[model samples]
Each structure stands twice: as C-alpha cells, then as structure tokens.
Target: MKYCLSFLLVSLFTSCKYFDVEKTTSEAILKEELKTFNWNDVDTYPSFSICDSLISKSEKKECFQNNLSSHILKFLQDEVIVVTQDIHDTINLQFKVSEKGDLTLLEAKVDSLTVKEIPNIYELINNSLNTLPTIYAAIKHDQYVKTEFELPMVIKVE
Candidate 1:
C-alpha cells in the first residue's frame, strides 16, 4: 500500500510538470505573436501618384486625400452634365481598394433632391470611377491589403 501511494504521488507530480511545460510553451508562443501583431492599424496608408514622393505619414495621407478630391472634382466638372438652379448637395462616396490595387465603388449616397435635380448622378459617378486611374493598395503589416475610404462630396450650383 505504501509503495502504491508513492507511485501515485510521483506520477501526479510528473504529469503536473508535463502540463506546466505545455502551459509555458503556449504562453511564450502567445507572447511572441502579440509582439508582432498590429492592432487594427495599417503600417502604411494607401498611396496616390502625387503622394508617393511624400515620406511623412501625415503628409502622405493629406496628399492622398487632396489628390482624390481633385480627381473627383475634375471628373464632375469635365464629364458630368447637370442642369439645375442654385442648389447645394452632398454625396457620400464610399469605395474600397483591392489588394491587387484596383478601386471599387462600394456606395454613393446622394439625396433624393439631388437625384431629382441631377437625374444622371448615378451614371456620372459610375463613369467617374471607371475612368479613374489605377490606385495603389494600402499596406498593413508590410503586405498589400484591401482598404475602404468614405469621402463626402459637396456640390454647389450657382
């Protein structure tokens, strides 16, 4: 009976050590992954040709936004044909850039009044996106990643 008790105690202690080793190994692996994981933020913002020369993160963002707005404005001015009295409206443009560096329009929300005033707004927006130049995809964790952008476009007719 004493020998059996000793064996049971030794086996329990040995099994505990095995579990401890496994636990330590798992914790170490988790810690190592945490060190490399980036929480919901990208290493680099999406780039535009005009912004590619910029080295500062904030400047790159600003340049990208400015150029995007300019591109949309130019398309609206040059391609879209609208007839309306003095009116102002805003459209929210939501789009995604693919990992393959292609742009896709997710949504374009223009008010009913604007739609009535400019009947072809939807077609115009689609055409604008189709004509837009190729865009660079965003970089996250040193890899190209798909990213979405929501831009508010305000149009004023005088």
Candidate 2:
C-alpha cells in the first residue's frame, strides 16, 4: 500500500515543466499582439459592395477609387458647370471613413479662382459624397478602423 501511494504521488508530480509557472495576463497578451501589428498600415482598406469581389489589395484599392470617381462624375454629369475662360485646376478632396463605415467629407481644397468660376463647387462635391453608397470601414489588427483619403480631381474646361 505504501509503494502504491508513493508511485501515485510521483506520477501526479512527475513533470514540473508541464505546469505554467507564470499566468498570462491580458496586458501581456495585448502587448504581444501590438508588437506583431504595423501601426502605419491597415490590413484592409475601406471598400464598397461592388469592390468587395476583388481579392488583391491593389485591385481592391483601384476598384474603390474607380467606383468613387465614377459616382461623382455621374452626379456631376446631371448638373451644368459653365466657365467663362479655360479653367485648369486640381481640387484636393479629403474624406474620412469611420470605423462604423460612415463616409464624411472633411475638406475640399478649391482655389479662389475655381470657387469663383464654380461658386457651388463645394456644395456639389459634398452632396455627391453624401449620396455615395455604403462603405465598409478599413481593418487593422483584425479590428475595424477609421481611415483618411485624399483624392485629387483635375478640372479642365475649354
């Protein structure tokens, strides 16, 4: 009986290596995850339903840009933009995509001359952005994240 009890005890405590000496805390796990993540880049860019079919990152980005540009152009096509002289300028449009997949127009960099030529240019651009379809927020470290984008539009009128 003594030998059997000793054997059982020895077997129960056989390997100390199998026991975890240090418990893993949430802080440690969070730090380890942060170390593996790249803060400067997102895992996935904001996308539209039409662009979601794309697989490659470059293809997804191109699809997003093309869809955005075409939507704005289509909206503009319905309106009439008249200029007295040839106006050549680039409008820098800044946008923000929220983690919840909401698109907001942050700013529209239009020159004084362009504003003068097209008084309601800002309004037109803002309206077009507001009318855009649902956008999926960007992804980083397996979590939804907000992203900023700047798209330059060239205006050339004869």
Candidate 3:
C-alpha cells in the first residue's frame, strides 16, 4: 500500500502541467531593446566626405539622404524577415535629425497598421536605425539643423 501510494503521488506530480512563462508583448520588446551594428569587416565601405568645399548644401543633404537609405536597406536585408505577402508596401517614417545627425524616432502611422501595431512598428524602425553605422558630418553654419526625413520600409511579420 505504501509503495502504491508513493508511486501514485509521484505520477500525479510528474503529470501535472506547469504554467507557461508569459510571452512578452511587442511593446515591451521595443522598449527594452538595444540593436548592434555589424559591419562586414572586409567589405565595409569608406565614409563619405563631409567637408567638401565644392559640394553645395543641397549636395550635402543628398549625401546624407543616400547614406541613411543605404544604412537602412543593409539592415533590412540582413536582420529582418518579411512574413506578410504585402511586405513590399512602403511605410513612411517621420523623424527629425539633430544638428549632430542623431535620429529621434517619432510617431509611425500607416493605413494598413492598427493603432496597437504602431508601437511595434516604431520599435522595429528604431532598432534598425540604432544598428546603422554613424555618419559623422559637419553641418554648415545653420543654427539647429532639424531636418525631416522619410524612408520607405518593407515590413516582415516575423
């Protein structure tokens, strides 16, 4: 009787289902995330000239735009995985670049994305931007150079 009782107790305990650890919401993931930039050691491109005398302000702005686009594209290519069929659709990201060229990630709104999804979407963009290599450029004497930049992104569900 004792042996049977012990076996029964052991089996009961062993067969019981343990509560699962709750999965974190996308917001939580976004809030606490830190992305790292991984530039290819051998194939890294040279930094562009920031102080070219011949380059006009418009040209310098174009350079900045191109640099930012390339950085974002490389990130999406390497780290992101698109899960949706309509992943090719573009999402406009409205943000500001400080005089120091630091990005302040702001509100992200899309027709396809629900209000709840906005936080996650913004987080993803922020992570991608954080991982991009820095562009060290001397902005010509324009006090508080705040520029708005829009970049197209293809979202992956994964």
Output candidate 3 Cα RMSD.
22.4
Which wins on TM-score, candidate 2 or candidate 3?
Answer: 2
Q: In model 3, which runs have C-alpha deviations exceeding 4 angstroms?
A: 1-54, 80-84, 113-120, 136-144, 152-158
Could you tell which candidate, 1 or 3, scores higher by lDDT?
A: 1
Q: By descending TM-score, how would the candidates be arranged?
A: 2, 1, 3
Lowest lDDT block of 10, candidate 2: 11-20
Task: List, residue by residue over 59-119, the lDDT tens digit for candidate 2.
Answer: 9888887888788868876788888877888888898899999988899898999899889
Over 4-58, each residue of candidate 3 has an lDDT whose tens digit, in order, gives 9999999889877664567899987866662432221211122244424424555
Best by lDDT: 2
lDDT digits (tens) for residues 1-158 of candidate 1: 99999999999988985676434588899999999887667777777787778898889877777777778777878854656676588889898889988887899999888888888887877777777666788898678998888888888755
lDDT of each: 0.80, 0.86, 0.55
- Model 1 — TM-score against the truth? 0.75
TM-score pick, better of 1 and 3? 1
Indicate the worst ten consecutive residues by lDDT in candidate 1. Answer: 17-26
Error of 1 at 12 (Å): 18
- Please give the distance, in angstroms, between residue 152's alpha carbon in candidate 3 and its true position after superposition: 4.2
Root-mean-square deviation of every model: 5.5, 4.7, 22.4
